[model samples]
Structures are given as structure tokens and as C-alpha cells.
Target: MSASMPQKRYYRQRAHSNPMADHTFDYPVCPEEMDWSQLYPHFFSPMDERHDRDPDKGKHGVEFADVGCGYGGLLVELSRLFPEKLILGLEIRVKVSDYVQDRIKSLRAAEPGHYQNIACLRSNAMKYLPNFFTKGQGMVYTMTDVEEVHLWMVKHFTEHPLFCQVAEEDLVNDIIISRLGTCTEEGKKVQRNGGKNFLAVFRRVEDECK
Candidate 1:
């Protein structure tokens, strides 16, 4: 009976053994094995410049998107300039992306509304831009309004999507050909020359939000 009791005890201990002990670990993080190429390719490369040709094509001044922002300098500037405008910076590289995130955090703490308008996200801006802004609906501000000295200190901006559509070349011609299109009336301007340049503002004919 004593021998049988000892065998029973051994079997009981083996039966109750931890199931996780025999399981194999998938992997351990190794510094040398890390694929940094897949992580931070853009960290060393110069960031591509993004030009939003038709700035007024999206939703009104509720949000602002800084596409392909490197180190988020422009985003920070926009935040300071327009505290009420919600700003988002998109970057692709892992290290730089993390850096921008930390910057926004610190800025938010230092100034009350300094970083309130800004944020950073790791993403491919080109691919995700459409996701953020609909066809005829995005935050847009008139260059004239932005250039206003009085509105510089104003925390909030009145939301208006309306603006005159003008090409940068036409603006130059308006200055040179007609002596700043000086003699010409508002609706009676002639096309003296044409070239591609930044489209400052365009009227939103239809509300995509509707």
C-alpha cells in the first residue's frame, strides 16, 4: 500500500505540471537583427514638399492638414499663427515620426494653446490625404485673411469657404502688364499671358458635405 501511495503521488504531480513550460518562445528582440531599412528610410532623405494647389477645396476652417511634413516646422508655425485651426502633421519615418510626436507633446505643455492646434501621425500623406478631406470639404483660409495683421492675435477664425480664384502668374501680370491690372475693371480683365503657378484660392461651388 505504501509503494502504491508513492506512485500515485508522483503521477498526480506530473499530471498537474504547467502547460506553458514546454511552449517555445517565438522570438527575442536582437539589435543586430533589427531591419532599420523597413523602419526609417525617410529619416535620412529630404522630405518632399507638398503644395495644396486649391487650398479652399475642402471643409471650412475646422481642421488643417500638413501633408508630408518633415520635423513638423510648418505645422508648428500654422498652430502659432492660427490657434483655433486644428493642425495635423503626417510623417512616414519611424524615428522622425516619434520626434514630431514628442515635439507636439512638449509644445502643448509649454504654451496653453501653442500645441492645441497641432498633432503628428505616422502615415503616408499622399495615400491618406483623400481620407481626411472630402472633394469639396476641407478647412481653407484666404491668403488675404492670413496676411491680415489684425487677425494675427485672434484665437478663432470665422469659417468661410468663399474666395476669388487666382493664379500666381496672373497676379504677376496684374502687377506688370496693366500696371497691377491697374486700369482694368474687376470683371473685365484680359489674358495677356498664361503659365502654371500656385492656385491661391478657388470658389467652392458645391458643398460635398451636403
Candidate 2:
């Protein structure tokens, strides 16, 4: 059993077990029944303007997900860039998830019409990803929330049945429009320091998750 993240960050006696992850989760039977209104309030069609009460037709479901979102840096940036697209951050750590939620609330209060497309939830991504993302929901972002990315992290994601590893040829395949390894200042810093950040994208495929 993998032990919980310990006093390395802060002192806590949280019980975490890979096999016992489901004990911490209460998931929906289907994606449609999931309540997204609280997560993306700005996307909701005004009730005053609507004739019938069909939330599904009016609200846009989550298209982007960042598994293991730590401090929710990516969520904040993505929400600003794609205000129309709904994005979610799934963090398993209790205190970390609470911090992210508070972060979103502060951002929303500070600026009008911000962070409406983003929300953070506390849940084990390894165990409950299927609960949030429907089949073929789109690309799953796997940027490590940790300071140093790990080999185990890559292996965990690559092993999941829902995601098929996009090959290196796919980079030069001229099919995928949005490419990984962005050429920004952040990218340059990693490049200069010889950072071992593995660049890969995974497409969600149909699978029987037992």
C-alpha cells in the first residue's frame, strides 16, 4: 500500500491506500446526472430567458480535465484563456483541494466573470476519473502537480485503459492541431535546465472499466 504524502510538506496523518481509494468516493451512475451548474455558473442559460427547464441542453459539460491538480495553477490559466469551455481539476489531497477551492473563490470575487469555467474537486483521479469524464470527452492533461515529475506518474497514466498513448509520429503526423511542448518562456526554462518533463497527449477511448 502506498503511504500518504507525509510531513515532507506538512504534518498530517491522512490514511491513503491505492486499493482502498473507492471508500473516499461517492460517484454518479452516469455523466448526465452530474451537477455541473455549480462548477460553471457562467455557462448556464438564464432561466428568465428559457421556456422549458432542461439544464442539459443549456449547460455545457466539462471538456477538459487536469488530473491531480495540486495548487490549480493550470486551472486558473485555462479558465481565463477558454472562458466558454468548462474545465475541472481533480485533486485527491484534502487540504490541497480546499486550498484550490478557496483560490477559485478568491479569483472569482476579485474579478467579475472569472473562474466560472473552472472548479476543483477532491477525489482520487486514479480511481474515479471515469465518474467525471464521459467516453471520448477529449484530451486529458497530465501535467504533474508536483515540482519534479516522476516516472511512476507517467506509468500510471499510460497504463489506464481509457487513454491510448499518442505516438511520436503523431507529433509530425500533421493531424493534431494543438501540439504539446509549448515554446513559451516556461518551455524555454525547462529546455535550458534540461528538465525531464515528458511531453505526451492521450485520447480517451471506449473501455469497460470494471
Q: In model 1, which runs have C-alpha deviations exceeding 4 angstroms?
A: 1-62, 138-165, 169-210
Candidate 1 lDDT, tens digit per residue, 20-88? 334332221432232222212211121232222234321142266655454566666666666655567
Best by TM-score: 2
Quote model 2's TM-score: 0.63
Candidate 2 — what's its lDDT? 0.61
Candidates in order: C-alpha RMSD to true structure: 26.7, 8.9
lDDT of 1 at 133: 46
User: How high is the CA lDDT of each candidate model?
Assistant: 0.42, 0.61
TM-score of each: 0.40, 0.63
Q: After superposition, how far is residue 131 of candidate 2 from its true place, in Å?
A: 1.9
> Compared to the true structure, candidate 1 yields what TM-score?
0.40
The parts of candidate 2 lying over 4 Å away from their true place are: 1-23, 45-59, 143-164, 167-194, 204-210
